[model samples]
Target: MNQKIKRTATKSVTGVLLSIIIFSFSGVHLPVLDSTADSYFKESITKAGVSYGVCRIINATVSVIKESSLEVEPAGIGLSLAIGQIVDPINDMVERLSNVLVMSITSLGVQELVYEISVTLVPSIMAVVLLLLSLLVWLENDRLVKVQNVLINILIIASIARFCLPISSIANQFLQEHFFEDKIVKANAELARGTVDLGQLNDVQLPKYDGIIGTIENGTSYLKQKTIDFKKAIEITIENNGLIIETLLRLTFLYLGIFIIQVLVLPLLIFWFMIKIVNILFTSAALTAV
Candidate 1:
């Protein structure tokens, strides 16, 4: 009789406390957590935009180089073919990178939408109703215990679903700040420099003479100057090829890291851990009841 009384009191207290918490949570927005998530989401969008912009600029520069013929000889020897060979692969990679950025942005937007819906009053009220049902089942005989467990499970899942993304977003932002910030900055810098270099390469043009005699009079000087300019352009292109390739690799790795953490790894891990904790708690409660 005394054990039964103690269990009843404990259940009552737990139910009241949970009810208060649920009511409070439903009535109020968690400003700190919400703001943090919003800030992180905005920052992620900005980064993706900047990356996309840089990629477009590079693509445009490469397109210009590929389309414009750089005649280095009178007999139709041009560097456009060589530029195309060098740039076609890089352009393809840039297009893929742009796609990835778009996907990342979309992922972030979806996450934000889910989070907004989860934290709204309707979900909170539903969770509260589930909690109340679980409490009522708790007060009943052991025959209804399984029903109570199901209600509790649903409640736990609802809670986790409501809050997991915001927590994960906070953690993702923290991880990015600690691990990826410096490297991303460096990668952006290198990409910007490479863009400028490619633009300069595109600007290198061979001087034109008026007519054949003028061409003949200045042919020697013209050939020498044009040769020097063409050689310089080739040198710039070769140098920029390695730099741009390295920078793109760095950006790809960094973005992949962010995507994995923000979209996949952290949220899944948190969800699994929360579910595990719920199972353990329920198992303990069951054992106590037995």
Candidate 2:
């Protein structure tokens, strides 16, 4: 009966994972497989180059979206990060609790906590799966099966943090820059006005006027006639934006920190903890050594 129950649980989990895989890939462009896949969307976009025509096109599309005369998309990028946090083993509990509280109050009634719960639930399930994988791996290992299972669990807990940090950083960046949209529009308008400021219209140096013969009026008129597209000030999402560029640069260090946590800190911590536990359990120098 116990074996049957375990098999049922395993099948259910497999079914759920398969569903998630289908959803993640749904509508995703793959040039080799789908007619809907645009050459650019199907292509890898690490950098701009002659062969990377797709990346260049991507850059152009982003420019259009960001600089849209229409209202911004209200899809709420922070929501995605919230989902990521729930899956994360190393969540900043304090911050999450605050978001949850605010979300609850604003939502109220049936809607309250529904969306929050939806995103947070995904990570929670993923964490359980990872934990189970850790347990199974430990049980199958013979060298220190009984003694170091707890250590393996700890390492698993620490390693999941790798996926969570990227999500949180993405969320945090969106939250910081969402308000800046207004400021960006206003700044672009001001820049446009300043460039077309009619006071210096005669200062422009045209083909007919040069070598100290340029007037302020000439300069102003010259600029007005120039075919610069000031309306297209914004051109990319946060991922490809200058506003989030500095924040992303800092996140580069955070990536290194995760690597350290995974490759060095986690291993050292698990080793030290297991050594102490093993010493206590076996109560013999020879056993601990072996």
Q: Whose TM-score is greatest here?
A: 1
Compose the digit string of candidate 1's lDDT tens values, residues 61-100: 9987876654523323555566667777678778877877
**In model 2, which regions exceed 4 Å deviation?**
1-143, 146-166, 198-290
Residue 190's lDDT in candidate 2? 38
Per-residue lDDT tens digits for candidate 2, residues 1-290, read 69866875675566456546534543343343222112211221111111123222323433333333122213234432332332222123222332432332232222213323323444455445444543454243575554445544443443333223223323323432453324433433432333233112223221333335554546765645531322122111221233223322333333333334422354356446655664565567557788
Output the worst ten-in-a-row residue range by lDDT, candidate 1: 69-78
* Candidate 2 positional error at 200, Å: 5.3
lDDT of 1 at 2: 91
Q: Rate the local accuracy (lDDT) of all candidates.
A: 0.77, 0.35
RMSD of candidate 2 to true structure, Å: 20.6
Clash count of each predicted structure: 0, 18
Residue 289's lDDT within candidate 1 is 91
Model 1 clash pairs are none
